[model samples]
Structures are given as structure tokens and as C-alpha cells.
Target: MPPNINNTTQLAQNSDKMAAPISPEETLARFEELSVLEAEFEDAELELIRKSTALNEPLWKKRAEIVAKIPHFWTLVLEQIPVELETFIQPTDFQLFANSLQTIEVSRFEIDDPKGSPRSFSIKFGFDDNEYFFNKELEKKFWYRKSKDWAGLVSEPVKIVWKKGKDLTEGLTDAAYDLAQAKKTLAKTSGGKSKAKAEASLPEYKTLASKIEDDTEGAPSFFTWFGFVSSYRWISAEESEEADKEEKTRLEKLKRGEKLDDDEDEDDEDDDADYQETEVFPQGDECATLLAEDVWPSALRYFKQAHEADDEELSEIDVDDMDQDDSDGEIDIRGLVSKGRTSSTSPPSKKQRKA
Candidate 1:
């Protein structure tokens, strides 16, 4: 009855049920995290981009100039955005220390338990101010394991990710005031703002919503997630803006019911096609800028798709008859390892025989 929602995109999304589910809080956090962590990610992504632009900056003098652009970019960004209070050179407890200042050192070492997609790294780095030397490992976050390999002098790029975080609380002090003022303005004008006063007080760390109370849904909702056609329209509008202005000047002919030119119609169709292509993957690159908005309605834009898929899978699973082996707790998972257990009856292997 719903007009047969079976389409290529719907089929694709259904097939991609394995994608991870993301929460509204997490989405809001990610958007904020991007802003908060942008300096680091941008520096990182730019280093990669600059490495691509190496030939553009062929000479050492130019290389230094190009490389110098990095810190300068940050300086410009901080100045324009008024978001960052200050920055300093320090490693986050979670970030790799590259006093060595060369990411090349990181690429040289092997991860401890190397697997299929072995992500190796090095440890030595050198900078004008200092050099960092490390042994053994670095750290791990989520699925990526960070490990330090062999130490060396400053021979290569350090793959340094300054893990340091900012006291967004300080930088956002003004933002909080502005947002609060906006709320008061909205309250007096809309009368709806005070209804959720307690929630309005709830904080949104990475999003404008954080400045507001959580009583309201803010920008996150389910309708937003499944509804991404707006993104396609946005991209189409973007590519058409400049041309649209010019076309408006030529509108007298069009308004007279004059025949449209083949070129103009084709160009319009092309713009529409580009937008359509962009719509295929809402979470792809086109939507990246959307993450920079004041409020990124997380639940509407993202969900832990994988977790939802897993739950869907588990629902179809007929494990109801299965009984837990443990008399207490969920299950004594150790029971499954009985054959590998070190009991008095079984002798240890040669590897452990020495022990």
C-alpha cells in the first residue's frame, strides 16, 4: 500500500544493514568532536593532501613554505572561527608522542600481533625543539590498535596525531551566552522555548543543542535519518546557484514561452543528475559539511546501523531453547575451554614445560 518502496536505494540500504548503529548523542558528539578534533584531523588529512601536492612544492624552500602552510592554516582557522581559545604542543594520553616529529618512524614498525591488515608503525621523531623516542607500544582506540615500533633519529614523518583536547568549556563560554540569549529571544518571541526550560538547560557539548536543555528533541529524530532527500536538493541547489543567477537575466526569453536551448536543458539535467548521484550515498562525502552545522540531528542523520541489523538478526535467531551452562550469572564461558584447561591430569606442553 505504501507505493511499493522497493527501489535500488532501498535494496542497497537493506543490504547494508551491517552498517553500525550510531546514537543521536553519539552523532551530536561526532559533529562536535569534528569541530573539537578538527585541528588534529585537518592537520592529518592536510599532511596527506600536502604529501600529494609534494611536486607542486618541489624545492626544499618551497617544501618548507608548503609545510609551513599547516600551522598557518590552523592560525587562520582559529582566527576566523573564534572557536579555539589556544593551542599547544602536547600529546593526549591517548595520542602517539612524536617529539621526533617524523611520521615516517611510525610507518616502519610492526604491530605486536600482526594480522591480515597489518597496521605497522615506528617510534622515533625529531623536531626543531625536541625528539621523542619510544619502545614497544602506543595505544588503542575503537578498532585501531596504536603501537610504536623501533626507535630511530628523525628520518621519516612521525604520523603524529596530537591527541590533546581543548577546554571547549572555555572557548564555548561565549557560545553558551549567545545560545542562551538566542533561547531567551526565542522564548519571548515563540512562547514555546520556556515549555522545555529544564531540558533547555541540558548541555550540548559539540552542538548548539548542547547549549540548550535536553527537554526538546533538538535536531535529532528518526524522520531525519530515513529522510535524506533534502541533501540531494541541497547539492543540486549549490551547483545551480551561480548559473541560476545568469539564467534569471536570460529569463525574459524563457518567460515569453521561447523554446529553451538544448544546452541549457542539458546543463539543468546534468545538474539534476549530479545531485541524484550524490543522493545515492547520503552519508558519503557530500554530507560531510553537514556535520559542521550548528545542530546535527544525529538520530535523523545517523544510527548504529550495524547494531540495529544485529538486533534484527538476533530476533530471527531461535536461541530460546538454548540453556546457559552456568548456574549463576549469564554463563561460565570458561566451561567451553575445558579441553584446553590445565588440570592436574593433563601434562603441560613443551612451551610451558620450562615454567
Candidate 2:
């Protein structure tokens, strides 16, 4: 009876020894699960980087475009502005001071023929120490559109005298009708101004009058006659004042010896290069809308998570110890596993090892 009892106790001890808290298969499965998680993390991280780059490219381009174009618009104002206000200054004085216009380093423009009048060519406006510039062609189309638009915005119609026919009886008849229409419109309007003031507004009248005297055609068509109307108006004082203020600031900067940079002048290298700084017009609030501030941090977080997921162990461990092999010439899985255990059989001594 005592021997059977001892055998039963020994059998219970052996059963306890066989039971392991975590098996080799389970450890391998855990490693594989971690590997899958790491793979997913890596994919997510890569995707985040790609998204960040995609967004960054356009944002930079837009910012650069805006910086360049704003200054260029001001340059256009400088060039064609005299045509609108020619009455105020002498043509000879304007020609003499035309060279002075180049002194304002805010913009740099060149005519195709430097010696000739600047009727058509290209212009570049410099900003940010010449780090950025906007260029555009100054063709007839631009001039025509810009003139009409500017006239509409800045001037009120004072008079419109259509050029009459060149033939004797027909010319007198058309002149009479146009004069009557002008008087009627003038009478209906509330403003009471001198005829001289009204006449002074109509700069186009001079052109139409010259054309009519020179033209041999009898009676011009309505389409052709419409071009002869001497439309004119007083310039908007408020808009002029605003523009003058900016121009004054630029001039003062010039007086202070603030020169524009020319180191990155692509114009010197390539004549046909596109210098048109197409803008992304940014209003005060709209400027903030373009920022990629949120996405970059999210990308970094994803990258960090990917790196963290690849680590084999959750707890602190000596990397040097991990690289060293155990007596069996295998990485010690016990050290890699989490701290949890149950009784298990041990390996045999060196002398008792299998051949």
C-alpha cells in the first residue's frame, strides 16, 4: 500500500512537470501575429509619407505663385497708368522721366527694342529681394482689355461725341443729332459742371476728331461710328490715393539704396522662359486654408508606430545579450518571451547529450 501511494505521488509530480504555461508553437504564433501587425504598420506609414509629399508639392507652388504675382500687378499699374492721366503731365516730361521709372527696383521690365517706345514686350516684377518674380506679355490684347476695365472702374462717363460723316450734307446732319443727344443727356444728369471741364474729360474726342478730318469715307457704319464716341470720365480719387500710397512706399525704399537681387535672374539665361507667376489669390482668411500643418504630424506618428511595432520585445533588454547564443547554439526564446512560466523538463547534461 505504501509503494502504490509513492508511485501515485511521483506520477502527479511528472504531470506537473509536463505542463508548460506557453508552448513553443504558441510563442511562434505570437511572433507571427506581431509580424503581421508590424507589416500593417509599415504599409500605413508608407501611405502617410506618400500623402504628405503629394500635399506639400502644390502648397509650395501656390505660395511661390502668390508671392511673385502680387508685385507684378503693381508693376502694370506703373507702366500703363500714364495713359489714363496724361492730361495732368507734359508728354516731354513723361519721356524724360521714363528712365526714372526704372529706378524703382520693385519691378524690372524690358522692351523688345530698348531704344524704341514700350508699346509691346514682356515685363517682370521682382519681390522678396528678387527671390521671386512674375512675368507677363504686354501684347495689344492685354492693353485693350486692361484699358477698358480700368476706364470702367476709375472713370465716370462725362461726354461721348461720335465722329460725324465726311460728306457735306450728311456730316452736318449727323453732327447736329450727336450734339442734341449730348445736351439732352447732360441736362438729365444732376451734376452741374463747366463745358470746359466736361470737354477736358473726353480725351478720345481728340482721336475721333483727327480720324474724321482725315477720313475720306462718306457715312461711317454704326459699328464703325461707335468707336468714334469720345467717352471720358473723371478718375476715382480714392483708388488713386490708395495706389499712390503703395507707389510712394516703393519710391522711398529706392531712395534708401535698397537694391533688388539679381543672382537668380533666369531672365539673363533664358529669354523664352515662362516667368509668369500665376497667382493663387489669397485673401486674409483664405491664406490659412492652404496650410498642410495637420497632415505632417500624423505622418510622423504613423512612422513612429511602425518603428515601435517592429521591436521584438515589449520590456527593456540588453541588445548585446540578445546577439549572444545560448549553449545549444540557438537564440534564447525564454528571454524573448514575456515573464510567465510553468514547470517543464530540462535538457540533458553534456555527457548525456544524444549523438
Predictions: Cα RMSD each = 29.1, 38.9
| Candidate 2 residue-wise lDDT, 12-32, digit = tens | 122256664565445544444
What C-alpha lDDT values do all the predictions have? Answer: 0.28, 0.29
Error at 26, model 2, angstroms = 1.3
Could you tell me how far off, in angstroms, the CA of residue 259 lies in candidate 2 after the best superposition?
A: 72
| TM-score of candidate 2 versus the correct structure, residues matched by position | 0.15
- lDDT of candidate 1 at residue 281, scale 0 to 100: 21
